[model samples]
Target: MRKLWLPLLVVVMVWMVAGNGEARLRPDFYGSACSNVEGIVRQAVRRKLNQTVVTIPATLRLFFHDCFVQGCDASVMIASARDDAEKDASDNLSLAGDGFDTVIKAKQAVEAQCPGVVSCADILAIAARDVVVLSGGPNFTVELGRRDGLISRAALVAGRLPGPDFDLDRLVSLFRLNNLTARDMIALSGAHTVGFSHCSRFASRLYSFNSTTAVDPSLNAAYARALMRACPRDVDPTIAVNMDLYTPITFDNVYYKNLLDGEGLFTSDEVLFTDRRSRPTVERFASDQAAFFRAFSAAMVRLGRLGVKTGGQGEIRRDCTALNS
Candidate 1:
């Protein structure tokens, strides 16, 4: 009986150790191949965004327009000229035009290297990072494993995405609806560090605007001047859009930095620095790029999961330029 007991103890210890070993190896076993493909896709998207003549800030705008409207379906990134008339009529300037071409080139290159494995969703994420880097922002790794969303709903564009005028509470709610936390909302809004906005979208804040909403007093002078120059007070209602004056192409803490300095270009953007609840997160991101990157990656992972109808739930349109016929 003593001999049998000793043998059982040894067998149990060996089994436990082996189980631990397999557990440790599981992530690598499951993730290594996908990681490599994701890396390749990231590099490919980066290369294309860098090489393209379109300004980095403009590209970032296109990316946001595409993703926020649909579930990063790459539909907004497609051109409709080859598709039917309904598709052509539905074409969005931000998506179906030059940006779509750029994504297509990148997607084609990635497909050649990795075949059917790499997802369009992953490509969009990589491309966005590339755009930020080109615009003069820090580079961060985006986690892979997002599958391409097949259906792109144009109508979802207006309500789903937050606009420039959204106050802190409204913005927080929008982010929450998408499964994002307050921290995520602040960090993700850091993307504004690189892009531009039309003055028309923000003119209300400068001219006769909401007084209850705090405007950065430090920014009032420069903001008013820039607005005057861009709008001319009485001429055309159209406002020529300009990229974020500083670090328009870079993805850095400069956005938060701008807010701290009262240089934020939009009312919604400046409010992050002033809001009591959100200010600390904004300052943290401003001071620590590493911290910002970590949070941003996490937030992006969450954002990618929002309203995503994956697998058979959606169809992969062969032509991203138009919805499925």
Candidate 2:
């Protein structure tokens, strides 16, 4: 009995020491430590970005629409209030254009307070959350420490970002290119639960057999009439617009429910339910708001990591609207 006890004790000691050595090999394993300057900078930047979003919800949505279309580049931020034609040409409305201005103002404030401490990418991320909140969605804290992009290529905008014409496959492919999974694709599209779109974007669905732009027949008749009124046939092709009339200011499972009922306004919105691969995720999100929020938050964290060049890889942009020119 004594000999057996000694061997067991020796084995326990070996196991304990080996476990400590393995833990040391892990890169993220650490003991309690003081938060660094980078941590403080991250917090400040997030706070400012969140505030900017609350102040300008429409702008945040526009910013997101522009960025997602083109590699998260900030070119869509460029606008001149005096030139309505120029603004419209770029698809920039007064509400969205002002939001861009607010982002710039917030960026300037952060520079004044932190001086090259926060990144444009981080600002965009936090601002997106604020947009969700203002639109009547859940507000969650975003992890920061992203650095600004030194370059903002306009050419990248047209081909990279998803548009009103894209189908489920195209949408999924774009998200995949950005490192987003199928789950992320469904969760992020839930954002549409709270915004509006131009009729020009979805008119093809109503008028043509183009599956990518076709409207669902199950939409509410009154809602359809309102959209048609706002976008009559004689209306200029560029002037037609449509709002996500239901839950336009709230973030919930209604978007998914709309899809379930064949009421999705955009083909992209409807494809989630139509596509074989994406259908399950859509149903899950539609059935559970809390689940949707959880997945959405996780996906956002992943999205914020896309193309992020941190530490020595990128510069902190003083102006979020323009490249470091």
Candidate 3:
């Protein structure tokens, strides 16, 4: 792990230097130009949500995937000709199309009124917040002024996003690269409460965790059986299960409660309680839903500011899926 941090730290230092546009973002950035940008996005999001509940988690996950990459620039939504874009990466291949569709639809509505005044990046930020609110989560203001990124490559995604199996140390180090703290990582993990994960993402916990233990010892025996039933051996890789078995559709601190009961779907998810270091925070969140909401809301605002492109750094992409000609 010492060797891992040394080289990774160098890469992060460079990313920080190149991607620090948070100071340039402001909530009212489009107030003078597209004052109704948030309204337009929220309306589109509500409509989409009515069509399919999947929009809520899909858009939320999309926002995370976008920011964890080169920055929250909507590069993940870019369509590549040769399958080399960020979305084309294996880690991102499972991203539901509804996530991309939400942003594109919102971008279209914004463009109709504001023309080149609004950015796809800003629209995405607003849409992300809209999804959270629509899903019974805390509502928070989203800062705007992000410009669409000019770069989108699969190679840049390696080691950027957190994995399902990362231990506490690995998770902390990876999030720290973006200047986020351990507390922030826990708050973000609350997102799992609302989304779904493919069977392949956590099947290792059931099938072949190690030579000795057939299943992870930390997993509750009943929950492990439930997982195996949903994702039997040789099950279709595309088969997905809700992240939170109790209240999967609602966004809440039940994730922490689930962690406490050893029902967390991923090793990374369950470790919040299994590891003594992060257990207290998990306990606090599980016992106090209000505290979890406050932390999650604040963390999301901070998340939107990561590696944003502002002013001349990026263009107001006329289309969310392609760069301007």
Clashes of each: 7, 7, 0
Model 2 lDDT tens row, 121-167: 55566566665655556767665554554544334344555666678
- Runs in model 2 with CA error above 4 Å? 1-95, 210-223, 236-242, 323-325
lDDT (tens digit, per residue) of candidate 1 on 44-76: 656656565343544455555555554444545
* TM per prediction: 0.73, 0.71, 0.94
Tens-digit lDDT string for candidate 3 (274-318): 999999999999999999989988888888888888878889999
Q: Candidate 2, clashing residue pairs?
A: 69-161, 198-241, 199-240, 199-241, 199-242, 205-213, 205-214
Ranking by TM-score: 3, 1, 2
The lowest-lDDT stretch of 10 consecutive residues in candidate 3 is 7-16
| Residue 178 lDDT, candidate 3, scale 0-100 | 77
- Output the better candidate (1/2) by TM-score: 1
The residue ranges of model 1 lying beyond 4 angstroms of the native Cα positions read 1-47, 50-55, 62-70, 78-98, 114-117, 133-141, 145-147, 210-218, 234-243, 323-325
Collision count of model 3: 0
Winner by lDDT: 3
Error of 2 at 256 (Å): 1.5
Clashing pairs in 1: 135-249, 135-250, 136-249, 136-250, 137-250, 137-251, 138-251
